[model samples]
Target: MVKKNNASNKSGNFKTNTIYAGDCIEAMNRLPEGSIDLIFADPPYNLQLGGDLHRPDNSRVDGVDDNWDKFSNFRAYDDFTHDWLKSARRVLKHNGSLWVIGSYHNIFRVGSVLQDLGYWLLNDIVWRKSNPMPNFRGTRFTNAHETLIWCARSKDARYTFNYDAMKNMNDGLQMRSDWTLPLCTGDERLKGEDGNKLHPTQKPESLLYRVIMAATKPGDIVLDPFF
Candidate 1:
């Protein structure tokens, strides 16, 4: 479905197929409580790069150095995570769930915040990048994967999970926590006027296809707070 140009934000209501533009917490708070079916969050990872990176050839590396991904400190980052997750909890339907993707730099902190806010722990999936960028300096192993944490609203909430669909994608084998997919590249990656990628951590559409299919049905309202 597509967002209509005239979609309005009426009190305690939200129009379907629309993108609300603002701080995620503020936007979710304004919506009627417990209205969303699924929330797929690609929130700021707070990369906090120490300095510019370079390759063996001394060519500069384009990395996640965006303003949105920078925070003053761990505490500041935790606070930001807490506020949005809390608001996300508020807007989720009782049986609603959320999926959060991040790298080691911030995923652990995000997990802590999620549990502190009472989200029941679910599976933590590993997204293995077939073409991960190498650790240029050889300081560490190739950062070949990212993590996706899926959670239910509460321990008792009955959430959606299409087992057959996921199995089908796996050729009838039971789907596992580790998934192999390529990084976003080529025409699928949104580009700026200068021909550089618009977002540093753009996820591949293939990854999202699995998530949406496994957790939601047709016509379900899905929200991506950080889009």
Candidate 2:
């Protein structure tokens, strides 16, 4: 049996719990087929980033140079991506949906793979960081946002969508294609014992809160494949 940890909001609001660690593909395979309500994947960007990067201002920027982010090449990366996506689709309920986030370096490839795998596209959301890091090298326009693609398991599946909750969270405005939010900062961010960032790419919880509130309902099981 998969062990689940119950997670609560600061106000004690309740919902389906979560699992902290494991190979998500193996974990998903252990689930009964068609069991998950939704999936949110924030896979590696395949940036091929190397070494530590710092700004002239002396602030250190966490580049994604982890071994897990490495791929021999695009073909290898695509193969890995396709394999996991197949697992995700098999575990998702027929009426369930998926959300995947990535930068320009990988989103196009991911979207293409989704099409090949038969996942029906819904909306592609752009998360625009409110305080994006500037291009200190001044080589190109600062990469300011990441893209998230929302899709259903198949064309005819009836996916869960919390329409009202999304509207409220957007402050009554129609939630646009682009979302402007701050990157993880300060105490809300996890840190290592030496005071460095915990995970080089730990996603913002507020971003997740919005995603869950918008895409799922209470009791709906959400699977984070790359969590």
lDDT scores in order: 0.91, 0.83
- Look at candidate 2 and tell me the lDDT of residue 144: 91
lDDT of 2 at 192: 82
Model 2 accuracy (lDDT, Cα)? 0.83
Q: Any runs in candidate 1 off by more than 4 Å, and if so which?
A: 1-11
Instruction: Residues 128-222, candidate 2: write the lDDT tens digits.
Output: 99988898778899989999999999999988877777878788977777888889989988998999887877778878987888878778888
Please give the RMSD to the true structure for each candidate, in Å.
Answer: 2.0, 5.5
Per-candidate TM vs. native?
A: 0.94, 0.88
Candidate 1 structure quality by residue, lDDT tens digits, 1-227:
76533223445787777777666788888888899999999999888789999999999999988888889899999999999999999999999999999999999999999999999978999999999999998988999999999999999989999999999999999999999999998899999999988888889999999999999988988989887
Error of 1 at 115 (Å): 1.0
